[model samples]
Target: MIRIVILLVTLVIGSVANINAQSKYEQGMGKAFALWTENKPFEASNVFERIAEVESEEWLPHYYIAMINALNSFGVTDKEKLTLQLEKAKKHIEEAELISPNNPEIIIIKATINTAWIAYDGATYGMTLSMKNAELYKKAFELAPDNPRVVLSKAEWDMGSARYFGQSIEPYCKDIERSLELFATFKAESTMHPSWGKDRAKEVLKQCKG
Candidate 1:
């Protein structure tokens, strides 16, 4: 009887610990997502890292860290630095992918990496870079069909890339058009708590449309 009583106590303690951990996970994700939407990715990354510590099995934190690294992949000319950044980003992304191979966010991170590569390559080969950018954006869209943020992010990148087009008005105009379209689409679907993509999308649209 004493052994059975001990077993019951252990089970009760385990259940309570699991509940507490789950609550922390949920709260962490909520805060992380809020930070992400507000363009506070550095803060979000920290929160996500904390979440990973508490729940190592969760994939979102690792994925977000990879994304933050990928987004910061500009002006890094040193091959060694670029390689290290990519490897660091890949390490977290691969860890997440192993946990959830079909995750839409993981696919988006892959697309972001592709974008970073193009950003690193810059204007040396305009057409090739544009083609690669378009391919990555399209793939992200296909993988996350309902994810308006993917479309919006593509639009932002297009506008950002246009500044380097030098005397070419075509690319700039195309980017503006794409940004407007994406923002409009996101606005139409704002009911789902479109997270950080909505306001950012609208801000970009206003810039381009004006």
Candidate 2:
């Protein structure tokens, strides 16, 4: 009887410890996200890196780190700086991929990174990375067609391609509408999982004709 009581007490203590650990992780990630939302990319990235150090088994922190790098690379006038930044992002992405192979989120972010390079200098990267980016987007769709982020990303890329060639953007506008619909009812696997791209979709929708 005493042994059983001791065992029960140990289990309760372990459970409480787990709860406290999870609470700490949530707090850290929440602060990181707030910083990111506030335009403090460096601070947010630092916090995410720290969290990743502690949450070695979790892929979210690495994902956010890569995402920050990818987003920051945008509009960078210095090609060399952009290359270095994206290279770091690729390292974080590799870490995340190791933890969660073939993840839709990871795949989409890889495509985003490639897109950043293409946007920076299409003449240099388009021939090499364009095909890979398209493949990554296609694979992400196949893996998680219901994922709003994937839908938004793929549709947005198509819209950009259409506008580049003076083609109609009407077709991809419908896909963006579909992404918005998915976002409306989408449920993330956890609070830590991604739930972005809704606002991006809304902004893109502004370009669509009524």
TM-score of each: 0.56, 0.85
Question: Candidate 2, residues 1-210: lDDT per residue as tens digits?
Answer: 223223322322222222222578888887776676555766888998999999999998898888778877877879789888899899999999999999999998898788888878899898788889889989999999999889988998788778878999998988999999998998877666777667667877988964
Alpha-carbon lDDT, every model = 0.59, 0.79
Residue 73, candidate 2: alpha-carbon lDDT = 80
Segments of candidate 2 deviating more than 4 angstroms: 1-22
- Model 2, 119: alpha-carbon shift in Å? 1.4
lDDT of 1 by residue, 137-196 (tens): 777767775565666666566556655554333444554455446546544222212234
Clashing residue pairs in candidate 1 are: none
Residue 134 displacement (Å), model 1: 3.2
Candidate 2 local distance difference test against the native: 0.79
What is the Å distance of residue 79 in model 1 from its true position? 4.1
**Model 1 lDDT, residue 41, Cα:** 60
